[model samples]
Target chain A: MGRVSLAGVSKTYGDPGQTVTALTNVSFELADGEFCAILGHSGCGKTTLLNMVAGFETPSAGIIRVEDQPVSGPGWERTMVFQDYALFPWATVRQNVAFGLEMKKLPADARAAIVDHHLDLVELTGFADRYPDQLSGGMRQRVAIARALAVSPRVLLMDEPFGALDDQTRRYMQEELVRIWRREPKTVMLVTHSIDEAILLADKIVVLSSRPGRIKQVLSVDLERPRDEDSPDYLALKRYLRGLIHAETAA
Target chain B: MSGAAAGTAVPVILPARRANWYRRLKPLVLLAGLVVLWQLVCLLWLPRLDRQIAILLPSPVQLASTAGKLIATGELPHHLADSLRREAVAFALALWAVPLGIAMGWWRGIHQQFYPVVEILRPIPPLAWIPLSILWFGLGDVQNEFIIFLGMVFPILLNTLEGVRQVDRNLIRAARSLGAGEAVLLRRVVLKAALPQIVTGLRVGLGFGWMALVAAELVGANSGLGFLINDARSLLRTDIVVVGMLAIGVAGLTIDFALRGLARWLLPWSQQQGGR
Candidate 1:
């Protein structure tokens, strides 16, 4: 029931004369509880695609639906975890997580309970009172994820959620993400430039071409849970994805 | 003696508490040095000058004695109260102007309508409006207050506008995606984000208000620190004038310090990041 379908979605910026095409005829469907990754180069319009789905930006031409209902604007049903971990700097971790619940006008006790639960889910229980600046980058992103999940959104949109972390932290966060997602399954769409990240986390990888982005390929990741990166199958898939992205970028 | 020699071999470590005490006293020490230097100037340079010039530049002791006299007569407090009352009125008025600025900053239509007028008037010093204020409100507290309002309002208005405008776009989007409507977004995200800048504007505006209050009093008001200085100048009481000037400086510093404390208390998160 949490299916997200984007059909012939296109987005253009600026006026017609100086127009920049960001995406072209992008079409895809995210099934209920499916973990999908949108892999692309820097200017591949992957973020634009994510923004459209999140209802932050409207597509110039397209129909986007979630659970057979069209998305007109941003709603709690489609929550986002931003790349920069846009946890409000002015707010404490608990307050940031509680924001959505507060907006929903939940009772004070109920809001607190949900915030506490999500903070626990993100393992930020003890640090809930701390401001975003006081935490490390990885911890801040975990707070951001906790904030997003607090709303109990049907679709969780993550745009390069681990892009800001160091390699070690990034890998660690990927494992944490999978563990969290497995615990509370939802329709997830993660956008990333890292092929290894896409292969490691996503059930299905949708590779996007550069500039006026279009889906170049959709590869199903049939790898087992807690997949070993050192295994031949994982290495083979990583090589294939790397080659695809490299070829598209080189072109 | 062998035990003493062994103890001397170890490195001496400064206690953290003593270091903190030194840090705290540094500013006071520097201030005392400044006073000493001023006294030296009065003794060495002023005494050598003509009597008239010497009278014009009173010694720090002379200034302090004059302040003591003013305080004894309760004249200083009376004049300060009058000036502070005018400042309070001006500040209250400036508070009303902040929302207008926020509206102008937030909405394109409102900004286009009001921002040009603000831009045009912003460059003109508040003192420049003194003549018009006198004509409009007559030589009274109203005239002084009008000038003070002019001085305080712009900084508050401009800073608030900038603060609202500069609210991170991503934060707004995040709020929207979190099911916040426009009203909730403005109240929770935009206003909270802009608070640090707004507090900055308030602190800056308060200093400007004090400046304008003095200027207004100098021109038209019957009482205030500025009037006290002006009256002292006419009476050739350079000491009283110096006292008034010192009062104004100290008062401004106190007010600024209080506002900084208020900002810290109000926005504790900003305090952690050392504010905007």
Candidate 2:
């Protein structure tokens, strides 16, 4: 189980005398196996918060704990899917998926097995031998997802994983992500700016105010799976969250 | 639908055969034109203008005949073999320099310690060390090899350092997030990312190395293309000198072509992506 808790997490950059705060007095808790989405405007420190949770950055003023242990540096338990789909262009899709497993010093056969499973999970079994440059934008992102999942991380942190994709591909990937998340239940923290995306996929949505980011609200999503956009309940929640985000960004 | 149907569904395709033929023959045509121009200037035009110029610069026919005589006596082949041997040794030494370059690029301390020394030494041309090389190795292949080594090492070293420094920060961060430690990060990500640039460095270094080879051999070598040219100059056999110059140019071109092929084979992804 991967339960992450951030208490009064504040990140300030530059010297203390002349500093710029990115996140201020931010607190959130993601329960085990819960899919949480941090929704905020650009420069609202959503990525900084996610990076802190991923242990890529340290919080200036608060404690971030994952499964009761203080976060240190990047660990295998918290794999990230970056927005740019950072698949190694030199490695084939199969090899890219196997990267984390190899880092963990798994045997060749086991590594191959896990890589094949993840590739198949992403429906990219046929393109196993192709490099990232040979794949389309969506295909590369799927490869990134497969690579991240191949290690069986305790928590998956995705930083706007589908932001670079077109609308059609983005919608398709959102569905694919949910389907995959259900099949392999792990605590997931997705950072995104899209209100509909947050409402559609997240079990809980945390909205933050712009600049020197502070938590504005945390709304628990109680809608059923495969929530319809046209449904009154889904639209209502989307409108409410959009209003909240719009207000924060506008202010 | 009717209006669209009236327009041609498929664009007319132009036959690429003529264009392909022209592209294929372009270099040879240009080279032949250059030779014709040279023959016209030296054999026909220059002698009319100044008889002494014709005596100094051999025409294409004279050069060809001289090359034929050398080939028949196997002298050209022997000299070429010696020169190639020296080149191979220098190139091998240059290959050894790559690891040090990689270390310097990867570690900040190493870069700090060695980079200033490299910067100070790099601007001084390799040929400037010819006298020192002669004093040390004393009129042998080792002296020529030293000059070539000096010429080749910097391009490989600097290019490798730049390649490592230019590796995408996001790629490293992504690898770290996937549990890669320092060694794994260097081996799997940094090395692979830097490879295309390294290959480019090797190619550039080899070109400089070949240029230095002639300079090195000119000073004190007994059996190389440079020596061939120097000997012909002393003997007043301008045709043989021209032949030696041609041989060096052709050999350099051939080796550069081979290295390019190697780069293409080693980095298929870079080729596909149209990376240099």
Candidate 3:
């Protein structure tokens, strides 16, 4: 069975006059240990769908299930990395990463160990005591990644996690994400607009149409993990993904 | 190595320690200069103290003598205690007002329902309510406390409401995603996000409260800095009035400095906003 599955989901926001249909009958399943990407335009209910699995929002229509159980409330088994990093500015990197474990009621030693372990994984061990303000954007995002991974969630939902970083930093983050995924494979659902990014990370690229987003197409990457962006195959795949987006817009 | 790099300079001293000392002393030196000019003006033009001439605004020498005698007589401590009590009571009462304001502010329906009434209550000045407070609680500590509470609560409530409203909607969504229920959301996310602004509000409110406390005390209270100056007015003790005035300024300045330090310690994240 899939680790994270969405079935016939729809979400409408607000009252009749100002109502916004954010998602319409969207369905997908993330296979265990696969890195899946949800690619769509900015307004395309992509984040909303992710919010459902994160248990931030319940589907207005259908249902979403995590590990074959109906997603009732936000579970510790699934963690989300927001686009803006959302690192508590008042907290040190270690404290921010320790938040989930602390919520889980882990003993201090165990929680500290897990926080240290993830910080090491993200190559931020030296920055544990440093506050988010003291760190650069890239470093902050790395700390955020560590914070999410520290919880050891079964399914990781990344919503434009590297969207705020510069190009070089974004590339570095993507590579690091792939490396982390290899170290400990969990069902990963990443939402992004960059076709190159989706191609680089996703085992399957799930494309959505514009507004009131629905699954327009799902394309298998066919390329291997830790894929090279400079390679001809990766570029070709990116062009194909871009073409799909253009086609959707044109229609 | 000894030669000056610049064309005009014979020797490069790296601007002497004397220059650094001068730079540090500049503001105090400027203040001293202003004092001398005022003294000179007073010496040349003003004849005597009739309270009519603006130039007769008590000389530093006169103020020191007045201040010294007031302290020697133990009136300073008595007045200071009275002022401190009013401030302490008002501050405690203001704390109670914040959660009440938050309840009204956080919930949309509550805000709508209470906003009109709150707005109506807010416009009436704390000073205007002095007569009623005196009538209701009589001329004592209770009346003084009531007036201070009235003075501070409006600004505190307005500030708290603004802080709650200003909290990022995204943070709320993020908290909900983390399994933060209503209680957790209020305690963890909402309160944390709103704190810096609330502190600012509290600071402003406390300042107004102090001013109102003095005003309230001046009317009928037997003790306090305000009462000290006021009673001195009838006795024609200008020295005590001057001492009382200076004491209020110094005390207010000290409390404001302490509050700024508290804001820094409490909201470390606030400084990192990076102009955004």
Candidate 4:
């Protein structure tokens, strides 16, 4: 019964003067424990669609629901890890990890246990006392992951969380994320422009079209855990996703 | 090994305890050299020994003796305490001005309502405000505080406004993405992000504030370094004036150093920002 659905969702900006459509009549279903990746070009509404699910933005039309509850606004039941690795710069890693727990108004002793658990989950246990800037790009993203997971939300929303990292770090993080995603299995909706990442991480890949984005296709990967990138099958799928994304970009 | 090469290399492989002091010492030694040359010139230019002291300079020995005696008597402490008291009042006034100014700046409506009045009053110099403040607040701490506040507020207000505006858009997006409600976003994310800038504004504000307080004290205060300098001028005691001037410079340097240390301690992330 734990599934999120969007029916005829649309988003438009501006008043009566000049209206701009970002998303139009978009509909999709994400079942429990599904890892779905939305991929698109820069100006495309991949992020906007992800924001809708994160409750940062509202669909101007149609219904969006998680477990049959209408999407109203951002709530703790859904957690998001942003691209910028937004750990509070003033806060130590442990404090940043503890913030959502604090906001949920959980008592301190219980909150500490939850925070420590996720910190360990992300393998950031020893670096808990360090500030965000002290950690490398990949480490900070792990801290953000720890923070999001600490709240134990219904679903996890990620918006290109590795976008700022170097290519090597980005690849390494994708592997770590797949491992974490399997163990900590929450339904995750990730927005990315990287075809390689989408192929690597997603159980179901939802391809988004260019600006004024609409879903073009959803390809489900029937592959196993830690799918070999060097495998011909994985390479073939990567090439196919890359071609579609490239065709969209060229257009 | 050549004596000079070995001596220089041995001492300078790493910089001195004060890194820039080695560079500054050359100029300082040059300055001392010039003073010696001046004294020698005065010996040639003037008639006698006593006349030479009057025409060119109080010899270093004389100034040192005066400094020694000033320290020995309770006079230095009395004047120092008075100066510190005025400085404390000024800094406090500056602190009050900053938060009020920042609050005004953050809310656009308050900024619009008050900015014009502040701008109109701002151009009138603190020296000019000296007379009016004395008249309105009477002849003591209040006048000094008012003068300092007037001097401090504008910089703090302008810088604070800039800080608020300069907050990274991505950080805000990140906060919102993480399901941060409005109050948490503003209080935790916005304010903390703006803090290094706010500390910078406070430093600049307090520097100007201290100068304003000294000017205000010159108007009616009977104690304080400003008064000490004025009294010395009236009594034709240049040595005391020298003491007062040196006191003010040293105290200002000390306070600024302390403020910088506080900034470093409080905002460790500032070090990373600077490195970038």
TM-score of each: 0.94, 0.92, 0.91, 0.86
Candidate 4 lDDT by residue in tens digits, B199-270: 777778778877886787777687777777788778766667777677778887787788788888878777
Q: Candidate 3's error at B138, in angstroms? A: 1.7
lDDT of each: 0.91, 0.91, 0.83, 0.80
Cα-based lDDT at residue B179, candidate 3: 50
How many angstroms is residue B123 displaced in model 2 relative to the true structure, after the best TM-score fit? 1.6
The docking quality of candidate 1, as DockQ, is 0.76
Steric clashes per prediction: 0, 0, 0, 0
Question: lDDT tens string, model 2, B1-276?
Answer: 785664564243233656778889987997899989998898778889898778899999888898999999999999999988998999999997678888998899999999999999999999999998899999988999999999999999998889999998778888998889998899889989988888988989999999999988887899999999999899988989989999999999898888888888888888732234
**Pairs of residues at least 3 apart in sequence or in different chains that clash in candidate 2:** none
The list of candidate 4 runs beyond 4 A from truth reads B1-60, B101-106, B169-187, B272-276
Q: What is the per-residue lDDT of model 4 for residues A112-140, given as tens digits with 9 covering 90 to 100?
A: 99988898888989999998988999999
Look at candidate 4 and give me any clashing residue pairs: none
Q: Which lDDT tens digits does candidate 3 get at residues B107-131? A: 9998999899988998899999998
Candidate 3 lDDT tens digits, A1-251: 33878899999999978989999999888788888999999999999988888887888999898889898767667778888887766678988888777767789999988988899899998988998888998898888778777778888889999999999999988999999888978889999998989988889889999787989998889886668778889989888888889998888
Cα deviation of A136, candidate 3, in Å? 0.8
Candidate 2 vs. true structure, TM-score: 0.92
Of the two candidates 1 and 3, the one with more favorable TM-score, higher being better, is: 1
Order the candidates by DockQ, highest first — what do you get? Answer: 1, 2, 3, 4
lDDT for each residue of candidate 1 in A18-76, tens digit (9 for 90 to 100):
99999999888888999999999999999999999999999999889999998999999
Best by TM-score: 1
Which tens-of-lDDT digit does each residue in B5-113 have in candidate 1? 7677544543665687988998899789989998988888877876668887888887888899899999999999999899999999899777887788789999999
TM-score of chain B of 4: 0.80
Q: Native contacts retained by model 2, as a fraction?
A: 0.78
